[model samples]
Target: MIIGYARVSTLEQNEALQTDALDKAGCERLFTDHASGAKAHRPELDRLLDVIRDGDTLVVWKLDRLGRSVQNLVDLMNLLQSRGVGFKSLTENMDTTTPGGVLVFNVFAAMAQFERDLIRERTNAGLQAARARGHKGGRPSKLGDRERARIRELYQSRALTVQEIADQYHVSRKTIYSSIKNTR
Candidate 1:
């Protein structure tokens, strides 16, 4: 039996890539976990470990998908070996059922961690460069400075309800409140 595992760390992270690959690889069943690797409790991972039987092969899209760190990966691989379950990583072409595959897994796991570190470093450097150019990276303001000033005046006068002001400005009450608060 071939059992696949898929995971995504955050809401913005999609599992389609992992799932699609697993499907193509002909996984008999796939387990998905939507939680950070740093998080200890992965319900689906626990479930997958429980149900996987001897002579079964566990597949993953990438080496990193299965482990949080190299140490954790080593521990997991050891556990899988003891249980008589084979492990395969599609991206690294690693299958622990073979002696060469076992050798490649360790090297590939380290390379995966290195690749992730490089990605994070590049992202941080890019953000720092953007900040240097005075770009505040977030959603653009809903209201302009002129409109904000007018909203502040109207709010101070207390002549209209917040809902009325919001309706007039075509924005939410929260926006109006924020605009008023920011000017003070």
Candidate 2:
């Protein structure tokens, strides 16, 4: 039995490419997920893993369709191997049942890990540089310091209502309250 898996990063993304390849490769059933591959939570993949029996071959259009991380791919492969289930990747031309496939998959896994590490190193270096320049990361404040001060003054003086302050700042009432709390 050949069970295929397909995945896409977003709800709007289509699964045609993976599905088509899986079908062409003689996949008997296909599971899909419309979630980021980086996310650890993949319901469809989990479901596929649950009912897959020994002698069943889990097929994916590409290794990346299975996971964005090399470690994750290796982990999944190990889990499948322990279950006595085989694995195949259409694009990578790999089948775990074959000696050549094992070698190719290992090499690909190593390269993927190297790529992920490089990205992590570069991102950390860039973030450190940005911090040195006094640049803050993450979501920007709903209101700037000047706007918050004005809101505080107006609110204390009863010159502006909470609703009015919120409207002026183009923020919700909850955000207005949170801003006040931060001031304290």
Candidate 3:
């Protein structure tokens, strides 16, 4: 069984072209999603995965239609391979049933891993540089010393409720409570 999957980032984008290609490729059943490829959950794709069986082939119009990143594509391919399923990308002319296709996918996975490592290295370098510059990355406190002291005074005097203080300060009740704690 050849099962087809199609995806577009937004509802404004049409899936007709992909559907046509899948149909031409002789897909017996098709699933589609009109959502960003970066999203973790895609309903139609999830359903397709649940329905596809071992010995089945999963077809897509293009590689990007199936995944947003190379790492994601490699992960999906690994899953399909482990399940004894084959994968085919019409536009890329990639068919995992062939030796050449497997080689190509292996190369792609290596490149993806390399890219991830580069990104991690850059992020760590950036953080180290920022620390050297005396930069602390967390959000600044909402209340300063004067505001915290006032909040504590108001609470001690029994003049204002936590919710009232929060409303007056344009913050949450939790923030007011924390401010009171800081004063003590």
Candidate 4:
């Protein structure tokens, strides 16, 4: 069976192009992921992975549709290969069932990994440059010092419930509990 996988990085992005392409390419079944490419969990992708069997073929419109990161794409490919499933990327013209296609996919996978490494390197360099300029990275605490102190007092007094404290402090119950736990 030739199973198709289509994905768009965001809710607003259209899945039409991929779907149409996959249809034209003769896919028998189709799955999709509507979340961002960087997200770790894609429900449709997971579902497809769970049911895909030996001798089945998985097809995608493009390499990016499979994954945004090199490690992710490589991992998916390895998993499919281990399960005796063949993979085909339309835009990249890769097919795991053929020897030449295997070589081409390998080279493409290497290049994707190299590109990701370069992105990481550049990001680290940028962060280091920002730090040298005395720009902190993380967001400041949402609660003011005085409010935190008051929260600690109220929590230690045992006069307020977690929910009440959260209400008074204008924060979530989880945040209130975390604050109390941290102070203790």
Per-candidate clash tally: 0, 0, 0, 0
Runs of candidate 2 with Cα error greater than 4 angstroms are 107-184
Error of 4 at 44 (Å): 7.6
Model 1, 35-59: lDDT tens per residue?
Answer: 9998777899999999988999999
Candidate 4 lDDT tens digits, 15-100: 99999999998999999889888888899999999989999999999988888677888889989989999999999888999999
Error of 4 at 151 (Å): 1.3
As a whole number from 0 to 100, the lDDT of residue 88 in candidate 1 is 92
> In candidate 3, what are the lDDT values of residues 1-184, reduced to their tens digit?
9999999999999999999999999999999999999998899999998998899999999999998788889999999999999999999999998999999888988999999999999999999999999998889998889899889988899898888989999999999988777778
Pairing residues by index, what is the TM-score of model 3?
Answer: 0.78
Local accuracy of candidate 2 as per-residue lDDT tens digits, 65-152: 9976778888898899889899998887889889888787678778878888999999999999999999999998878898888888
Stronger candidate by TM-score (2 vs 4): 4
Give the clashing residue pairs of candidate 3, or none: none
Candidates in order, TM-scores: namely 0.57, 0.59, 0.78, 0.65
| lDDT (C-alpha) at residue 99 in model 4 | 100
Deviating ranges (above 4 Å) for candidate 1:
106-184
Q: Could you arrange the candidates by TM-score from highest to lowest? A: 3, 4, 2, 1
Candidate achieving higher lDDT, 1 or 4: 1
